[model samples]
Target chain A: MPYNVDAVFQIAGIGIIVAMIHTILKQMGKEDWAHWVTLIGFIIVLFMVAMLIRDLFQTIKNVFLFHS
Target chain B: MIQVVGLGVVATILILLVKEQKPMFAFLLATFVGIVIFLTVIGKITEILKVLAHLANQAKVNQFFLETILKIIGIAYIAEFGAQVTRDAGQGTIAAKIELAGKILIMVMAIPIIITIIETIINILP
Candidate 1:
């Protein structure tokens, strides 16, 4: 996939939104919800990064003639 | 090139803005941006390598040597990227280990060429 800045923006937006939710939930005395929100956000970003990393490794292997 | 720089700068600002509240996200953002930059330039690198390979073929250079050299370059690039990301995440020891591994792998990759050179010298002497 072509490199797009949209992923970066999406990740940053998620981070900001998650943080906001976490703060609001914690202030509401729902600490568990806050943690869950943060965890979900992190997982989403992790998946995105993992896919990108896989693409990168594939490209590197193809360019460098790495068969295994 | 300019687009890559602009993305980096924008990512940097976003990372800073997010860092105070979510350091993990900031780290992820850093990694994501790094990958994006690498991927963006990868096409150019591939084109350059293709041109280099064509030139080497024209020069009658050993294909084996060219392939090994390209592998070494790829390893170095990957290792550097890994080390930098780890360093950014504040894992100095892991970064150092990654670099050491890269160096060792490179040396291993060169051994065949080294042996060939020695054998060639021996044949020349006889």
Candidate 2:
């Protein structure tokens, strides 16, 4: 996984946005929907991260056994 | 690398500021920051693995040993990740179980290497 400062910032930005949305939703008396939003945001960020992590694992496995 | 840590600190501050009435938000922020830190380090892992692979091949080490090491590392990472996520999700007990499973998997993976080393030493003595 290539560590780009930009990507880190992007994730942080997403967090900020999620927090804002969560707060707004809760205040509007939609707690159930707020929690769902939080969960979806978490999943989305993780999915983006999982993509890079997958590459790292592949590289490790190939390097260890195939020298590629 | 430095930037990632800096971001984590910033996120920590933000979490602290928001956590009292926004516990869920705080948890999500911390988790995201953690993932960013993890991704930053992953950038370095590829080069390290490449070097290790070159040396292992040159030294003619057992491929199985490499496989075992890789598997153990995988278990450790997954278990730790699972445990951390559970903790963040406010389920500390599940984290403990995940960590326990990781440790057991690592031990199981190491047994063959330990036995091989012992056998090699005995052969050398006789």
Candidate 3:
């Protein structure tokens, strides 16, 4: 409905935290864990975006009368 | 209106902050903000279209033609939004392809309108 200002901050926070964890893990010689952390963080953000996109497309189809 | 501007500025600042550490997140944030802005404005767009449709009906315009035109407009808007987002991510080639696809689809939708106009013109000449 309204603009989601919180989502912007939430994503930024996740990115910062993920980057920090990744660097820390790499420094500790756990490259695999670092990659995993990045992957998981990306997937989380992707899920959030996927839901938003779905809503967007649905609204478009309804407004434009895309019966298909 | 102010809210949309505020959201854009805030998102831009946040994107910049995230870009230094994670460029991928920056791109996703850009896309997320874009979708949010579009979603927020869509309601207003629907209201405007409703008013236009009501006016068209009062004027006895063909409903099928109006529907086709609206579909064309929607396709253009979607294609432009998608291309701009893709370009924001530095994929100029993909953005161009998206635009091309949109143009073709719009032309396809406009074919019936074009045929109708041609038919009207031919009938008037007789």
DockQ of each: 0.69, 0.25, 0.72
Chain A TM-score of candidate 1 vs. true chain A:
0.91
Candidate 3 residues lying further than 4 Å off, grouped into runs, are A66-68
lDDT of 1 at B18: 97
Least accurate 10 contiguous residues by lDDT in model 3 chain A: A59-68
Per-residue lDDT of candidate 1, residues B1-126 (tens digit): 688888988999999999999999999999999999889989998999989999999999998999999999999989999999999999999999999999999999999999999999999996
DockQ of 2: 0.25
Q: Candidate 2 - CAPRI tier?
A: acceptable
Which portions of model 2 miss their true places by more than 4 Å?
A: A1-68
What is each predicted model's overall lDDT from 0 to 1? 0.93, 0.71, 0.91
Docking class of 3: medium
lDDT digits (tens) for residues B55-80 of candidate 3: 99999999998899889888988899
Winner by DockQ between candidate 2 and candidate 1? 1
Best by lDDT: 1
Model 3 residue B92 lDDT? 99
| Candidate 3 structure lDDT | 0.91
Fnat values, one per model, are 0.71, 0.13, 0.68
Candidate 3 backbone collisions, by pair: none
Question: Candidate 2: lDDT of B122?
Answer: 96
Give chain B TM-scores in order.
Answer: 0.94, 0.84, 0.97
Sort by lDDT, top down from the best: 1, 3, 2
